[model samples]
Target: MLISMKIVIISSLFPPNSYGGAEQIACAEAEKLAREGNKVIVLTLKFDKGYACSTSDAKNLQIIEVSHKNIFNYYNIGKKSICLRFIWHIIDTFNFRLANDIAEILKRESPDIVTCHNIKGLSLLTPLKIKKLKIKNYAVVHDVSFYTPSGLIEWGKEKSWEHMGVLTRIYRFFTRRLMSYPEKIFFPSRWLLDFYYKNGFFINQEKLYKPNELGFVCENKSVDSGGKVANNFLYVGKIEHHKGILLLLDAFERLKPTNVTLDIIGNGVLMSEVKKHAQTNPNIKIHGQISREKLPEFYRNAKAVIVPSVVYENAPNVVYEALSCGVPVIVARIGGACEPIIEGKNGYIFNPGDVDDLVEKMKKYL
Candidate 1:
């Protein structure tokens, strides 16, 4: 027997506007719930020239896009000055306006379960609002944004929740207090789950180490051309310093192996630098931001996918995607990035920030 209930999912972003794995997962979760005969409501942000609000419905799902009332939209945070960014975070912390908007939707929908993902832009006080309505609220941890606004901790440069400045300490104190409103929380990896627990964030809440859902299974679509396995490698992610794009490029250049190629996907602030490297290295190809539906073609042909993130990731989707496609993975051993790799069976792991270790591992497929 199957039972269907009304569910409301709140995320900062949703499909079409989704820029990362977290948003994709939220969309998938909503669709799955709707397909199971449940009425699903997704409350997310709308980004336009003026941040317009709109609503639409399809099948058993309804999407309500609320305009953010902060100084600027969340997507423009990178372009703002430090002072403006600080002010924006403060406004977003409590976000009375945004909470009121979401509260209205929750009250109308009166959902059975309220699940939230990456509520940074949506509002940190979202869980508290849901609880105020006496609804069962659950949150999913996607990254380290709760600890730091940037959601980043460099592998070699940053300390582990230590040596916080006064402002940062104050920020975390309030963020931690507000986030504790969730009845139960889900984490994509044990590293992230432990991170929150160790920082004394969600001490009384029930925590579960639930790995990210694949959303869709990929079929092995391409047959290998039958050549040297290491001849062609793939990297799919943001092209930025924290993602270790430069490090991967440097290693590939050092390898300097004949007939070897590296296909880089995705785009970010480091696009110009990546382009400069691509211009210099004939063996490296930059395919900027391939659609999700078209990624399997690249995965099936490549010998292995390399995740060279220097930041402490909370389990990336690429590793799982590659393994599901029957391709091996060579990942950096930092945070939860290396959690899924079984070493020699599915993939291999190298010490983070170690060029020699990465090159040595790259040699195996050569």
Candidate 2:
């Protein structure tokens, strides 16, 4: 018989304040564990505009939002300047105050295990606190944030280890010790796991390439003949430079298919540029970010999905979500984005930032 155990899940963000896939994945794990008769306690940062604590619909689930004393909240980082961001990273690297807050919570709850995900905003030294308290600790790598604060190095512009910038070298120096405190570390992609290994991380911990759960249930909408509801291609993710949103837009424009339409979802720094492009092109439509409940409808209505990230994306949620809906994917041949795809099979892969290569892949679906 399986005994119910208390599990503490620590994430930087959760639903209602979630900006990306990592948060959703964390929420899904917590809810699933709760459903299985485990006492799941989720500790996350309290954003300025969000509730102090989240009320969950799942039984045995409790959420406690703690304030991380910092220059600014993590969610609104895009609005801050480079100098503020640099200071934030410095404070986050060795935030003993926030670590004490986490220690107090752990002392009160005294859970069986502590699992951390995306702990940049919440504090990277959290594992160190957990270690000192003799808690069984596990961690999930959602991105390259531990090595580089930006969580990205452009697709082809990645630097060699010795040639890395001072920021990354310094960040990794601290994180390398902090990361060792975890008993085990989970990675969503083998490529990402290897990247960390090459960068000399998690040498003393058990590393597993465990893909993320889709987080939502969606009926296979592409059950019909040809598996397409319309001539629409969907892009659902952050509109950031490393996401290759501009590359996607440029490729789509160059293709200039009259019968096909492109629908963009989500919001970010490049939102204005996307809007400008949409204004000039009737075939392009920008719906901005929508509720997760409504994402299936968009996936169902789309002929295909595109993930054109220029960064080392570790198994993006969109790839799994689109596949679950039976929608084919066309992704950049970088990072783990193309790991789930088999050329000319369920989806296609193109060279990252190569507009012509992307157009060629899109032509197959069109």
Local accuracy by lDDT, each model: 0.84, 0.87
The pairs that clash in candidate 1 are none
Q: List the residue pairs that clash in candidate 2.
A: none
| Candidate 2 residue 18 C-alpha distance from true site, Å | 1.1
Predicted model with the maximum lDDT:
2
Writing each residue's lDDT as its tens digit, candidate 2 over 1-366 gives: 253999999998888788788988898899889989999999999979756645469888998888979888888777888789889989988888998999999999999999999898888789999999999999999888887877777876787552287776888898898889999999999999998999899997999989876834666665324664568899999988988999999999999999888999998888998999999999999999887788887887787899999887988999999988878899998888788898877899998889999999999977
Candidate 1, residues 262-349, lDDT tens digits: the string is: 9998989999999998898899999999888888878888878899888899989898888888888899999997998999988899
Which regions of candidate 1 fall more than 4 Å away from where they truly are? 1-3, 50-58, 160-163, 219-222, 225-230
Where model 2 places Cα greater than 4 Å from the true spot, the runs are 1-3, 50-56, 160-163, 215-229
Reference-based TM-score, model 2: 0.95
Q: So what's the TM-score on candidate 1?
A: 0.93
